[model samples]
Target: MSGNTRGITREKALQLTMRKCEWCGTAIVYKNAQAVYCSSRCRVYAHRARNNPFAALRNEKRWVLWDTNKRPIMPSGAPASSTDPSTWSMGHVVNGHLNIGFVLGDGFACIDLDHCLVGGRPNEAASEFLKSYPKHYIEISPSGDGLHIWGTADEGPGTRRIENGLSVERYTTGRYITVTGRVFQPGNLLPL
Candidate 1:
């Protein structure tokens, strides 16, 4: 014991401090400090709990679109024909010069975060914002600082909330995210 009435010792406390799963209370050891759940199932359940119980039909895959001058365009550098991938090209004319969008239809949406990046990492405010939805597919935008959060949010009109260091935009339909597969946090598809 480390001078405690309950006889709890420093050794015991140290062992319990970082090795327990936050969801199931199981003992675990993780090399990554961000790990919390003991298993993906627990993680999934916890993630689903944060969302509304609305059922959504998910599409299997999505195509990336391109745009510039804040006017969205297809990957072929032409005006987007439809939100569906079938109507657009997946290749960009000037890869780095062009802004991008992801076709958002068939029950899909995304949360976009910009300007919350510092030295290839998200700042405290961005990290805090992401914690609210831990199970969504998080991708680092081509800008290397922005973030794209893809999931099954409602097809309601897009909404944007901006802060001093970050801008958060959400879109449900007729919106395509600039495509990048650089996953920061890998998890199953999110649902609403």
Candidate 2:
């Protein structure tokens, strides 16, 4: 065998004596009895691979209300009554409201919610609606049993108008609303 071939065989023999690479799962061959990696290139590739998944998820165009940590503050109990002014408080509004649609920076729109719970339980009617419509909608207060059905304004066929005067504007402290049997202003709701 050539000198390089002989060296490789010797390295392979030495590698059989030790553990393999943790990242690539390749055996580490030692020609000089002290090799750490099967190849130097493999070491560099493994290092870069660690951060690639996170980067890819961020770059994708999707509606994600929660941060990368996946921590969402959910509310408990029934929804506020329409006539109650305290229901619109910040604390109640923040935790009680569900993210129905998102507006992308590029002006493109995407729907996020696939399955949502309504009226303190998964809404069979809404679930059926999704099965038939295949559209995205979010339920903020499943216990109260209301769904915030929405899609990107740019992508939606048209605007949604609720007879109760429901809107998609950001919650303000002055707005009167009710949540969980208690009446409060917008200040009572939790921030997203």
Candidate 3:
């Protein structure tokens, strides 16, 4: 038999080490060892499933579209009320809205950290807080210098705390927070 130093032909060795595509179960031949999908279509589908980090939020009914000014508006550009369900739209609808927001209530709260980034990284206080509270869906704000930490908390009035190093606002009701879908830490919304 034609073989190399290891006594096994290269073709036989490749057959022994062959792997299957993760998405379609196809036998992957030309891809690298780290390849997961056999083709770009499979890769796209896998990414859509695994990285839809906001799937849980979309399943909820507290969604609304926002305008350029961050004000909640209906899909037809009419003003919307966070307290009014009739004005709200399903979270899954795209509807040509420039931005998306979620009404804060029903035990859900968002900790909005304003200007919490320094030199393209989270500031010290934000980093410290994230280390302590790492089990929630955290995303960078639209401005790219802040973070929105979403979690569950007791229903309460909105409160703002400003310090020398950190500025934070917590809201449990009567407000809508813009959704950027820019994830910093991927996790489920946990209790705060």
Candidate 4:
């Protein structure tokens, strides 16, 4: 009965049984007769991951490209119309360079694209890649049709190796790949 004891008494264990997931508040039950979570889903939700603000921003369509003053920058060179989905692309400011590229996938109408390497519009080369894929990720090529999409080996179809003169690491699921032509490495990415 003492609080310092390692194990709980049967009565206390029954009293402490969780009724819901601690993270998402989903219903839970001790099916194994000694378990805390009803299912593995609740356990993973409770302890597997941390909240990410960038991911939250990606989910919400409120993310925008603005200057330090919060002034929205018009996407220059964007197709006047959505006539050819292939022609539409996004730009991001990367390393002070405006490396514009088109986005691929649904629900990305409001994602801002700036230069990924220099912090401006993507150059003509990167923009061409965007025009080709129009999806979340793509490959960079010598000619057109090179969209360098950054994704992990687990979630998507194909995997390509990218070298930026830095050590490459193993890929994992749920990593954030920005349309700005940069892959947000889990630990390397700045905390939101």
Q: Per-residue lDDT of 66-96 in model 3, one digit per residue for the tens?
A: 8778889888789999999888877767434
How do the candidates rank by TM-score, highest first?
A: 3, 1, 4, 2
User: lDDT for every model?
Assistant: 0.63, 0.32, 0.77, 0.33
Candidate maximizing lDDT? 3
TM-scores across all candidates? 0.56, 0.21, 0.68, 0.23
For residues 36-82, what per-residue lDDT tens digits would candidate 1 score against the true structure? 88777656545543433111121133444555445556555566644
Which residue pairs in candidate 1 collide? 101-176, 101-177, 102-176, 102-177
What local lDDT score does residue 81 receive in model 3, on the 0 to 100 scale? Answer: 94
Better of 1 and 3 by lDDT: 3
Q: What lDDT does candidate 2 reach at residue 98?
A: 47
TM-score of 2: 0.21
Ranking by lDDT: 3, 1, 4, 2
Worst 10 residues of 3 by lDDT: 44-53
* Candidate 3 vs 4: which has more TM-score: 3
Lowest summed lDDT window (length 10), candidate 2: 183-192
Misplaced by over 4 Å in model 3 are 1-53
lDDT of 4 by residue, 1-192 (tens): 656376777667755664665433455656454565555644543342334313422333222233333333334433222223333323322224333222322212222222332233445544553353243333332222222333212123223333333212222221222234343222211100
